[model samples]
Target: MKIVVAKTAGFCMGVRRAVDMVLDASNLSQEPIYTYGPLIHNPQVLEMLEEKKIFRIDTIPEKGSGIVLIRAHGVPPEDEKALKDAGFTVINATCPRVVRVQVIIRKYAQKGYSTLIIGDQKHPEVVGLLGYAKGNGHTITSMAQLLALPRFKAAVVVAQTTQDTAFYDEIKVWCKTHAPHYKIFDTICGSTEKRQSEIRRLARENDAVIVVGGKQSGNTKRLAQIASMAGKLVTHIEDASQIDYKTLSSARSVAITAGASTPNWIINDACSKIETNLQKLHPIKAALFLLRDFLLKTNIMAAAGAGFLTYACSVLQQTAQSFHHALIAMLYVLSMQIINNLFTIKSDKYNHPQRALFYKKNRTYLWVLAVISGGAGLYLSFITGMLSFVILLVMSLLGLSYNLKLVPIISKKGQIARIKDIPGSKTILITLAWGTVTCLLPAVANHSDLMPVAVIFLFAAGLVFARTAFFDILAIQGDRITGKETLPILLGEKKSFDIIKYALIFNIGIIFLTVFTDLLVKRAFFLAFIPFIMLLLISFFEKDNLISGAHKEFIIESSFLATGLIAAVI
Candidate 1:
């Protein structure tokens, strides 16, 4: 059995330094030693340290006489002060890269550059950087939100040491646009870039790739994402023992990569297991595996299309008046065909063959479903009333325009493409559509007063904008890669983040005004608004990732649906 290891395997500089510092302090310390947190990301390493009588403490103990080591992820200044005040002997194992972030932040603050740290606010490194800035720096996670900030002069941009390099570049460009004089310090560690690039290269070449690291380690998770983008079979694992041998039984070649904190032994153990499993598979079985993979991919596409159409039906039913209104519904269905075609054309040449195939295979059935439904909808609307028919026609056009030739006209002209590419467009469009369909479509079809309709549209627009901006923050990378100019890409991460902040503030203001204007039933509507506020709070802390993005959409959609249901009942 042969084992191949990635060139960048094992503990990185920060992890190495932190581990060594802890061991050295343990050797010399007389009192029982403790780490402020896990000294490194790897649980194996922490377990070993615990065996040696080293332990973790969240805060300085009451007696506080033991040697207290700070983790590679530096602690906030106030916490460090509290530890020192408690009479603990402190050993600072803070990574050099993280230290640089602290220095840069302090420098910017001293120079009066209204400093901004573009990173996760809850992250230890980010928390430390903020403390070092001493209340002068604002933390931003995306560029679109940053642009909406009250204009600041002499802004200096820095990132969390583990942040994506491309995101850092996007933030720099955004600051250049909004700030009078902007300075960017590329503070991301070189090891992170090297590891990410290496994983991408491996994923492109390998049949399958395993990214081994702690789930909580940001850098390791990024390596997994790079592998996913290359369209390789990637599994992220915390240790060698967690590897599912059954999944790799037929794999001929598998590449292994680890995060900054992963130990060399773990990588080696996983590789050995992979080779042992492959040896047990026969040639015929391997061929069977490939066939199984193909069938699974095909089934997945069919299932997805069916699911989407079902959801669209539910949405239409909620908005439309009667079963006879199915003709207008048919148009809505037809519009989906146009969207599917546009996506197929745009994505066919991408490296992910599975995605292209999925779109192509399901497109025919999707189109048929759309056309039949749309045609039926139009005929029913005409039979019912001219006004209802017109509304259906307009909606069908809007849906088609979003993805087909009509929307491409905006893309080709550059102005509209640029605007849509801006971070907030998708969120803005989806939310607005939901709100409009829920509030206005029913009234217009029934010839109700326009005043209530106008109020609903306005209120819905505000909430939708808030929700969409947050999702845009999550999709910054996809938008950048696909050349879909979004707020995060155009304005940079920090600026884009500030824009979301301002948007939320404005949204809250509008909600208050609507309350005073009696647009909402004071108590019932306000109670419903509580969930949205909670969603906003959750979005603030969300890490920019696919799971978080999905979660954000789920929360926003639920809020929209709940608000609509509550309003309808009232």
Candidate 2:
């Protein structure tokens, strides 16, 4: 079986903008936050917001407090004034396309034009549009209803932003022939149009179509309606659990698409479940997938990568007993990475659902592993040398304190009580820690000369920084919702990617340069290929997303093992 996912699936621009606004507001202030109604039609998102303590108010009280955001579907002009009159600070998160329709209706209503809104009468957006029409408003859902209305002397036609484009088109044709004097405006949102168009093609090409979204969403329902009209088997589900796999098992190919309000995680989860169910994998393939997932979820792959990179760095610097340093690096990284994932469960819930579940179930065992690994690393460093031991101890203390409140005397107005609150701190701290374990500790232990040590440290730190920042770019959505000001969120994804690519390029250059300066063996040039490969992977993943989340991570972690391979070959 094969699965084809529509690229247009998932949250549209207006939905994304609204979600970002609400999340940003929740992150920045302690005020009681509320959306005027459900933020979007998706139940999962509504549950997440409630979990974050950002609730919604369906009604306006005589006196309100804190902040309340207008829904993405928007509300009437009078309701906006009422919320302000009720003493709530209003943030208009109304979809811009919906706002455009409101503007059109308001402009013409003042000129005594009856507004003919082509949409479901009870839908939120259409109701909002009706408000702008004052007393001169008529909503028609069918051609019969459109014909039943008296031909107004003066009228303006508009649509609900998510209205069915084909139905709206039919209305336009009828208006053109029967009421040539009436004015019609093309108001269906571009996002909606593209989604409908794509679904038509997918329905024709695939054996079955799976539409994921809230049933309440007008656009989502329309997608299912359209797919069924295409004469293919269709299943409209809210999430992965609703999928009726037995019915779909007969299909050779399936196309998956989601509504504008549906989130990426939900779609990803559904796709993963569907694909796995259909595949019924062979034993070897199943084992490989499980092993890869286990290594990533336990942070073992990442720690092993650190160990390999440390060994390669040790070789470049001509250190004695490089294996001891590699063991230390692996232990320290395993400990810190485990603790980091534990504390980041909130973000992980969105960014990595499977890992989040694993951590939640194995929380106690993970804590024990962190303690054992951290203690073992310190003992190894102590036997190596006093300087290395001291350095590792201080680094461990900092790692432990990363999520803890270390800054004192913070007032309620200031949320900067933890080191994690500082923007871009995660990437910076991760780089320094990795560099210290992989490069600085080895140098200090062996008493390497200062110049060569500095060069090796730069090479290690550059790669570490690039790796951390690249993952941050991937997790920006989850981080923003969970209120973590990571490097990508601070500088934006494009800028961060540019910086990461540059850092990787610089690492390759410096590692190669070390050979010319007599700082490293000639074989150091081969080790330079590690960062160059990473640069290519990052570049490729950015342009195309052929790889799934887990497989992509496995390949990236495997890149570090390449360094060890090259070192062994030489």
Candidate 3:
């Protein structure tokens, strides 16, 4: 079955702002952080926040300390003032869109104009908006209510931001005919309008539509309402486990959309669940999918790629014909990759859902395996020489500390932090580490000439740099949403791509240059084509959405495997 996901199916600008603020606060603040309410309607996010020790307070205490954030749904001006007056450092995380509506209402209310709000009468946003109306606030849900209210000499009409556009249009029509002089502002959020319209299109084109979000979420529920109105089979689910395969089994195609407050992880989980369930009916296909996931999830494919690159690099450096160095490289890479994945599961939750789940479920086993592999690699390095042992030992310690807090209280206020917090550090550090293990360590082991080894190191590091940065580009969306300042996020996607492209070209040139100058054997030249092929594949994937998710990752990783194959033949 084919599955389509809406581009706008995750967190809207406002919710994302609030979530990012909270996450940033989590890392920076010494005081306990609290939100005025659940940060957003999505339960998963709220739960995650709770796990991070960011609590929520439904009612204001007479006195409070630490920091408190207003949720995405704006609160009354007085409530905000009270929170600050109570001595808590207040960060207003209210949606800018909602803040605009409040400013309008407050401006008009001060002029003695009655304010009419169009939305659910009880929603937090509407209630907060009502606060700005001073005593002249009124809310109406429908045209009947609008028609029943007495006409005002002068008033302004606005919406709850997430209000239904069509319903608001009808309200506007009633106001135009009944009271033409009243001011009107279409305060419904543009994102809400786009989401509603997109769901309508999705419903029309697919056999079934799945609306993924909190049932309590107004915007999420409206999406379901719109899909139902379009006469499509609709399922409203909060997460993946709630998906009913029996209902979706007959459908040949499905469209998945999530509410504005929904996070990407939930959307991915729901899609993965559906795909998994659908594949289960055919044992052969199910087995294949399982194997593919296993290879990628366990880091086996990545390890194989590392081994292959080590072989190619060894050949380029004219190293001895022992596989010990190659084996050490593979084990070192495998250990680091697993440990890194375990540390980065939060971002992986968005970039690679299945791999995130794999790490989540097998964390203990994976941790043990990483320790064992790392130990074995270090043992082999010891066998090589004292220098090799010390280098690998120091590298392993640095690897272990990569995610640990290295700089304490660099800021005026102390906070838990690490080298990972440094922008663009991940790509550079991984490239250096991989180059050391795959290129530098091997040369040290073989006692090779410094000049050729240096050239080979550049070639290896350049390719690894290009590959890592490209993956960073592909994951920019999730990285940006999660507030990770990766290389692509810091430099922007287009510039990052240009850098990767040029770096690949440079790597190709160097490979050929080494061969032509008789610095390396003729067979080493073929390895240059490996990166050339990768450059073409990346360009193809970028030009057209030719591949995505696991498939794209598998094929890119296979490029390194292909390097090993070409080297073996030559």
Best by TM-score: 2
- Put down candidate 3 lDDT per residue, 1-570, tens digits, no spaces: 767777678789899888878877876788999999888998877776776789999988889999999988899999999999888999999999999999999999999999999988789999899999997989998778887889899999999999888889998888888899899998999999988888888899999998999989999999999899888889999987888888888888788899999876577656656656767777886776677678878988888888888888887777785367878888888898899889988767765677888899999999999999999999999989889899988777767666776444242234556667677878998889888988888899888888888888888888889888987876665665555678987887779888888988998998888776767778788889987988898777666431334556778888988877777777
Ranking of models by TM-score: 2, 3, 1
Off by over 4 Å in 2: 173-182, 406-416, 508-517, 543-547
User: What is the TM-score of each predicted model, taking all chains together?
Assistant: 0.48, 0.90, 0.82
Q: Higher-lDDT candidate among 1 and 2? A: 2
Q: Give the alpha-carbon lDDT of every model.
A: 0.61, 0.86, 0.83
RMSD vs true structure, all candidates:
21.8, 2.9, 4.4
lDDT of 3 at 546: 19
Tell me the spans in candidate 3 whose CA falls farther than 4 Å from its real position: 172-180, 315-326, 340-368, 379-389, 403-426, 445-456, 462-556, 562-570
The prediction achieving the highest lDDT against the true structure is 2
* Candidate with better TM-score, 1 vs 3: 3
State, as a TM-score between 0 and 1, how close model 3 is to the true structure.
0.82
What root-mean-square deviation over C-alphas does model 2 reach? 2.9
lDDT string, candidate 2, 221-334, tens digits: 999999999899999999888988889878888998999998877776677666666555445645666677789889999899889889988888889988999999999999
Question: Residue 129 deviation, candidate 3, in Å?
Answer: 1.7
The better-scoring model by TM-score among 1 and 2 is 2
